[model samples]
Target: MSETTTAESAERRVRRRQSRRELIVLAAVEVFREMGLEKATLEAVGERVGLSKASLYYYVRSKEELLGHVVVHVVRAQEEALARVLDAGGPEERLRAFCHSHVRIICTDPVGRVSAQVALSGIRDDVVRRPLHEYMSRLESILRDGVAAGVFRDMDLRIAQHSIIATLNAVPLWFSPEGRLSLDEVAAQVSGLLVDGMLAKR
Candidate 1:
């Protein structure tokens, strides 16, 4: 075959491999979410995707590597979603948007629930901590900008940033799909409360 055709064929194979890995990662997410990560195993993850343990190795090198992929998929999505709101909005708007996005994801999305409850704890500490640290930094930047703009009360950003995230992270612990408040209600009320708390004195 010509070089160009050979390259095209190789590209197709890479895409197929990536697609397969993605499916495996998604399956691993479900298994990890259900089994508390420790009880979950490579054999189980493979079973979920109809791959033998050996077959799984064709896509992911190890359980740690697979978990790393899962973290990337989930966190990158969250960072992208929150960044869009915070990067462009005014202080109040961005804070409100950030709260809404955070609550919606953690309480409602499947991988998001995994992210809040169990996704980042045990595997690839550096891989997990760096993205989360950067995300927290972005939050601090927006909050500081708001304080400077007189949109938010002058307060310790360290306290404020952790308070906002930790508060939202607690939601999935008790939030239920069958609860009296719908997901929309929870997002609205909680985000409103968070935003209101940060508003500058009139």
Candidate 2:
């Protein structure tokens, strides 16, 4: 084959490999969510995806690695989504968008919800802490900006940031698609509750 054709063929192979890995991660997320990260086993994940335990290692080094992929995927998505909203609006608007996005990610999206549900305690600290800290910092920055803009009341910024994050992070634990409130309604309600409280009174 010509060099160009060879490169194209190699690229296709890489894409196919990545697609398979993603499929494995999705199956692993379901198992982790149902069984709890500490209780989940590679064999269970392998069975979910129709791979033998040995075959599963071709895609992931271990159960911890698979969990790492799952969490990182969701975290990266949240980061990207937040990045888009950060520059698009003033602090209030950005905070609203952030709240909505958090709910949508952790409640509306199944994989994202599963990712959120997985306890970070089972994963390595470095694997879990960096992205989480970054996300927390992003939230803090928005709150700081809002306060500086005179749109938000002066309060304990750290407490406000943690409260907002904890509330949204708990969505995957109790939120139900079959519940009376649609995801959009939950998102709006959450945004209102958190954002309205912080608004400076006239």
| Whole-model lDDT values for every prediction | 0.78, 0.81
Clash total of candidate 2: 0
- TM-score on alpha carbons, each prediction: 0.83, 0.80
Each model's RMSD to truth, in Å? 2.7, 3.0
lDDT of 2 by residue, 155-199 (tens): 899899878977887877677879999989988998999999999
Worst 10 residues of 1 by lDDT: 118-127
Model 2 has an lDDT value of 0.81
